[model samples]
Target: MWHPGLVDVVYATVAGALLSTAVVAARAGSPHRTPSRTALVAAVGTLGVSFLVQSPAARGVQNHLVADLGQLTGNGTSLVAAYALRVMVLHVRYDRDTAAARARRWLVALVVAFVAMTVLFLATPTVPGRFTSPDAPAGVVAYYLIFTSYLGATLVSLALLLGRYLDTAGGRWSRLSLHLHRAACVAGLIYLAGRVVALLVGRPRLEGSGQRFNLIELGVTILMPAVVAVLFLLGVLIGRGERWLRHRRAYRRLRPLWEAARAARPHAVLPVTGGGARLRLYRRIIEIQDAQLAAAQVLDAAQRRRIDGAIAGAALTGESAAAVREAALLAAGLAVLRDGRAAGGDGGPVTGAADQEVDLSAAVARLERVSAAWTGSPVVHRLAAPPEPANPR
Candidate 1:
């Protein structure tokens, strides 16, 4: 006996998550609009809708309306495949003029195919029931043919596109995305192929064979939705993992400066309690700013001039020179604080630039480079190191 309970619930949940995530991603990219972005989002969102409506939890009534919706949802899946193909084409060749013409041809084929499928669905005498039901009439064969062919083409195109993407993709996040895309496409193909075969072979013989091959049948029914769920969950996990890695990396790179600041001026330490990555990163930024302010009080003109001269003379150039100079200056300031002496009286307090935009990733990237030389720089050793204790007074 085939019960739809588990598969339906799983489908609904996974579909809901995929849709929600895509929506959030789209909204975040509101400033950048492109035809490819629109196609990809629509494709994904339509597939989500197809899954959502067919779920057993959503089939509240077994009336003709509900059954028609189920059938219509099948077509939605085909439409999704069409749009997915278009998305792939656009991704590979983003030329608007040429892509628009090609996309229109695809769209027209999809519409014509959809119309044919819809007409067959209405004319067919399918029992108002779950997708796996054996009560479908002869006309259902035509419906499955149209549905399966379009869906198969879409999946094939998607798989090919993902293969290309995987070849070009570098780093962890891009690899993760490609893996999920391929896995999902494979699962979709298996599910659609099974439906096509089941329809062609007729239900009575299929049910009889199911008794002998119970495990395969069970796998076919249960594993489709399960794979889809895994795909969605993997995407969410990878995204979160990427973010955590970035935050931790940034935090670690800034640690040397943060430690030095805390030692030289304890008052610069912020009263930060427990928090997530973003909050912790923010507090660390604030504390570092406070340390810079405190160091500025004792940092004198001669030391500043000397650091400037060293910066001008350093072998490094361009952005590297600028970044190294900042690190060297901060190091010198720390030394002055540590020694409790300077060539002259304190300069006025320094603070974070009010006019400058603070990009966390960019800041972290610069600091990571600076960290490579922070402890070893000769200027830092000369200026920031604590004065040796005099012979016992």
Candidate 2:
């Protein structure tokens, strides 16, 4: 008696998008392929299929077909869990023979479970568009056996994944893998638990024309897909998010050097690019390098000596020294340029050696360091300070 609604449409849309993004991500050259990535892609693809089958659009006809597909989707969870376990064991460097033996045993179990689910669903037709209640007693029993067993298996796999993650040492791959595995595990557990609860307690009472519907099943159907989709998408984005923040921070840090150089030679600055952090960072690097080159042409020997003295006086070392030295020199150059312009001296480029290639990465890192210490740097403060009037002569 259930009907397709807005919730089903929304779930389908989101699931479709998630599946598409996963497919794109999975398309690395074959050289980059790994068992873990392959299994994850398969899991996401199979989950998308489940979303499609459960969607309102697929409900009007072919009830048996949809039921079979649903059973198959449970196997997808098993596949992902098996591969995740394999990855974890490999990461921990378990003895190869033992690991392979354990993996083979699990694979056999997974195949048996999949086969059992398929056979059971084929034997009993699902009540079209109604998962909570089936017309026959056999159908009811089949439903519970297939789902609860699958759910129990899934829960075990997820527990293993979580436990391994917690026990293992930390690394970039470990963190990213944990994020992906954790989201998938949490989403699957929630959906599976909800279904089990509904199956146990959502009984129907005979009424005049029909039976009382299970509200729990209805809510679960409407909500689970959306929740899972969002979490999965977030897991995919975690690494990208960290990279973006890093690049953006570096871009902002270089603002002081870029601004000072641009002031002396505005034409050196390039037009800003649009879109994400990576594009902007690339443009920032190019423009900052260009500005430095232009500024070098205008700086005189006397001004250069002053900047060198400021760098020596800064008395910094290591990465910090590299950053502060660049900032102090640039600040001194800006001061000299400003004074020259104020005194009616042309700020034109003076003949100098040809431009050398800039180390964009190092420059950006140093600039970021400079930005971090700008307010506190004595050299910067001195360069920026107004000249003291000569003592009364």
Candidate 3:
């Protein structure tokens, strides 16, 4: 059997992680009211509350009434969480109207189950710690049965939904989160099954059966749900980490281009400051776009055609070819500005539709390509070079 102190430590750790995950999810979704975001936040937040109320530390000092109330609250919240998870998956898998209809039916069923469990608990005679004994009244047994049955069913349904969703999930982080949630559901089912067996067979008899039996019961009844909690926490962390890394990577990739743009038109730089990686990237893209417009004003048709011909002859394609051409044009314009052959146009920045309509990710990707070509492309290098000085005969 596991040491009692070690079990307490594990339980405490899992509870803390669950609570942290809930807080993070709530904050992350605070700005959005999309069905998927709201459902996910509700699911995680309720699950965290369930575990917190049922924790050993919280239950240790409670009187009989308080303990019973805590148990009912924990079980009710857990059921709600299960339903919310199902709704979240539904929103992901089906259209909003269909998902909403199905979710309403499930929510009604959960409410009924919770009410039945509460009524059964209240009808049972007052016992210390409420249902701690194997010989507890039939009312207590019925209460547990309803709670376990409804929760088990919800977990099974959630697992099935997640399995179907997993097959079609395209993003790496999405698949990972689904896999973690599916594993948590399986662990929840195991915990519920153990609750059912213990309720029917008596906990004392199971403990007296054998050391091996006791160990198995302890693991299934206690450790299984802890595993579920940890899995939920991991799912939250993994998704957050993936998004942070993507934003940070995009910010880094755009740095060289942003620098070039700043050098070319120092006066056009925006005065924005103090934001996260994603916001910084947005600012950088806008500044680079402003510089590109400035460059466009100085270049005549011949210079534009020459840059395009050079890119085409170099056998580049797609965004890379376009990026190289843009880089050459910008460099040539900057050269002309330096030589005083062409005016730098109006000090006021020119606004264009291309910056407003392109998707942020696509814009970042194209600019990243341009950044690479600006520094490394030999064809761009030749075109960006200043015109040769005239020779006198």
**Candidate order (TM-score):** 3, 1, 2
lDDT (C-alpha) at residue 181 in model 1: 68
Where does model 3 exceed 4 Å of error? 1-11, 28-35, 60-62, 95-102, 129-179, 201-217, 267-274, 290-303, 326-363, 385-393
Q: What residue runs in model 1 are displaced by over 4 Å at the alpha carbon?
A: 15-46, 60-62, 66-68, 74-78, 81-110, 129-139, 168-177, 203-218, 255-323, 329-364, 379-393
How many residue-pair clashes does candidate 3 contain? 0
Q: Among these predicted structures, which one has the highest lDDT?
A: 3
lDDT, each prediction: 0.65, 0.57, 0.73
Name every residue pair that clashes in candidate 3.
Answer: none
Q: Give lDDT tens digits, candidate 2, residues 167-277.
A: 773547447745665766576677767766555543443334343344545556566646766666666666556666777888877676667667765766676646567
317, model 1: CA deviation in Å? 7.7
| lDDT over C-alpha atoms for residue 353 of model 2 | 22
What's each prediction's clash count?
1, 0, 0
Listing every candidate in turn, what is its Cα RMSD in Å to the true structure after a full C-alpha superposition? 7.2, 9.8, 5.0
lDDT of 2: 0.57
